[model samples]
Target: MNFLGFFNITTVALALMFIGSIGMLVVKKPIDKVILYSIVDAGFLLAVVTFKYLDVAFAIAILGPVSTIIFLMSILKIDRIRHNNREGGPNV
Candidate 1:
């Protein structure tokens, strides 16, 4: 790719990450926050890949899915705990 093309791609990725960050800040839902954070991570991946940072890209690619999985798991755990507390049950 040409220099201009690379620059454009990187710029777009940065812009996406910035927008996702703003969305994350304004959102109150845990799911929505996770989605926005994932988007930001995707942007970072795009930027690194476009810049030919293959090692960084691979590392971040692995982290992206792992992080999302962990976030979802935590959210589910919290919801279950809250529900159990509300019901006054100790998971029979």
Candidate 2:
């Protein structure tokens, strides 16, 4: 509504995005990145709700992490398989 309100929205959105990117890029651990990404998605959902985009927010809430979890699961599984090899690697 007001300039300050819009500025607040922008600042929040930017901060969330920046935090997400930092987590995704700077963190060496995959689990931490996934958690941060979920946080970022929740932040986005909050932003959308603030703008009265309830439908979009709901869609994001329902669908945002499905693929991410699937991918993470796959990666973990692959890591497990590799570690389970007979070469005496560390197990997951």
Candidate with best TM-score: 1
TM-score of each: 0.77, 0.66
Model 1, 1-92: lDDT tens digits are 56775568878899989999999999989899998998899898999999999999999998889889999999888888889999998852
Error of 1 at 66 (Å): 1.4
Residues 1-92, candidate 2: write the lDDT tens digits.
56776567756866787788778888887688778887687667778877888999788878887867886898798768776886787665
Deviation in Å, model 1, residue 17 alpha carbon: 0.8
RMSD of 2: 4.6
lDDT of 1: 0.90
lDDT of 2 at 22: 78
The lowest-lDDT stretch of 10 consecutive residues in candidate 1 is: 1-10
Report the number of the highest-lDDT candidate: 1
> Could you give me the TM-score of model 2 versus the true structure?
0.66
